[model samples]
Target chain A: MKVQVLYFAWLRERIGQGREVVETEAATVADLVAELRAREERYDLAFSDMGAIRCAVDQALAPVETPLDGVREVAFFPPMTGG
Target chain B: MSEADFDLGAEAARLEAGEETGAVVTFTGRVRGGGGLRRMVIEHYPGMTERALTEIAGEAARRWPLSGTMIYHRHGSLAPGDRIMMVATASRHREAAFAAASFLMDYLKSRAPFWKKEETDDGADWVAARDADEAALERWNE
Candidate 1:
């Protein structure tokens, strides 16, 4: 499946990019994350610790177990502090 | 009533217009100077911010017999005098309105995907999470 990935705040800074389009065969959010982490040194560093990051599938808040099939977008970032 | 650039007086009048609602609670948050920080730039994950906010409002509605609720949050650059966000809740009793309003604000503060950049005279820096904020959320646990 093809997914558009987005990075926010420090995650974007660590990855050195804001957004990208990736083609992956992963079925779940965690699987896709693992795939990204294996891509390069930056990706590995950006996703080094999932505990410090949060994921959103499409636009809704999602857990790592969330399925990725047919998902058009996936975003990762630190815990939000917006009001 | 729903509005973006809300007028506080108008919102209060609307919330308490009818005799049916006996209590109303509102919380208005302004852009703080961050001690000595000059300006603040708030960034949001466009689509996700709205979704999270709507979900929070929905949760408040589900938890209380609310007559009305409103949340207005501003994006982009803001200074010390600017209004950051507001939450107004109306119910038959003060307790529910107050609790829901406060709960909604706390949840929005931590769970919503918005980032703030504080600009000082020296340089700009992203705002970090406060221990107080985490503790505030802990209140819901009890």
Candidate 2:
């Protein structure tokens, strides 16, 4: 499956881009993260601590265990600080 | 999304409030000055941001008897004293309007996909999400 991965805020800064289209066979959000982390040093650094990052699948908040089989978009970023 | 200051008074006047509407509640969030802070920049998830906000507004309406609801939030660079966001809720009674506005705010503070970075005289840094804000969201679920 392919997922449109997005990064926001500091995550975007660290990853050096806002979004990317990834060709992956990962099944879950955590698995997808591992694949991204393995791809480059920046991704590994941005995703070093899953506890500090939040994920959303198809614009809805999702946990690391969330399945990505049918999902088209996934976003990663720090916890929201908006008001 | 607006870089210019919003006319909140004008906004409230344009809000929907028919003869049945007995109350209209509004809340405004502003950036605080001092601490040598120069300005702040907000970033959002674009398409997902609007979707999340609409979902939250729907949740607020479902939770309370609201006649109308409005949420306006700004992105991009903002100086101190700038208005960060606003929420307005109209209902037949005061409690519903107040509660709906509060509910929308709570979600905005946490669930919204917006991030703020503060630039001060020393340098700049990303504003971290507070544990207190996350804790605040729990009250609604409880």
Candidate 3:
């Protein structure tokens, strides 16, 4: 399966790019993160503190345990600070 | 995502235009200046941002008897005292209008996919989300 992955704010800074298409067999958000973290030192460091990270699946906020079946996009970022 | 400033009076006037609307409430958020802060850069997820904001505004209307609601937020570089965003709600009565506006603000503060980074004399850094902001959302959830 393939999904468009997006990074915002510090995550994008840490990852060196804002967007990418990743081919993965991950079933859930956590699994996808695990795959990403295993890819490079930068990914591992950026994802080191999942406690500070938030994920959205297909543009809607979702928990890490959220299933990625049929999901086309996933975004990772720090908690929102909008007003 | 627009970076241009929005007019509150114009928005409120438009929101309260309907004859059925008896009251209108508006809230404006501005960047605060202090402690060597040069400017703030806001980053947002493009498609998701519009979707989240629309959903939040829709939820506000569903939760309250709002005659109309408007939410406008800015992205990109902003300086101290710049108007960051504004929310206006019109209703048959003041209570609903006020509550809905507050509700819109609370949700926008947390649920909206926007992040703020502060550029200061020392350096630039991402602003951490406050626990209070998360706690503020709970009050709206039944």
Predicted model with the maximum TM-score: 3
- Winner of 1 and 3 under lDDT: 3
Q: What share of the true interface contacts does each candidate keep?
A: 0.75, 0.88, 0.98
Against the true structure, whose DockQ is highest?
A: 3
The TM-scores that each candidate's chain B achieves against the reference are 0.88, 0.96, 0.97
Error of 3 at B134 (Å): 0.7
Pairs that collide, model 3: none
Candidate 2 iRMS, in Å? 0.7
| lDDT at residue A61 of model 3 (Cα atoms) | 93
- Cα-based lDDT at residue A78, candidate 2: 94
User: What interface-residue Cα RMSD does candidate 1 give after superposition?
Assistant: 1.2
Off by over 4 Å in 2: none
Q: Which stretches of candidate 1 lie over 4 Å from their true place?
A: B1-5
lDDT of 2 by residue, B66-134 (tens): 888888899999999999988888999999998888888888988999999999999999999888888
- Which candidate would rank higher by lDDT, 1 or 2? 2
Cα error, residue A12 of model 2, in Å, equals 0.7
lDDT for position A80 in model 2:
94
Report backbone clashes per prediction: 0, 0, 0
TM-score of chain B of 3: 0.97
Q: Write the per-residue lDDT of candidate 1 for residues B1-142, one digit (tens) a residue.
A: 1223567778666888678898999888887765777887777888888888889899899989999888778877788877788889999999999999999989988888888888888887787877688789898878
Q: TM-score of predicted model 3?
A: 0.97
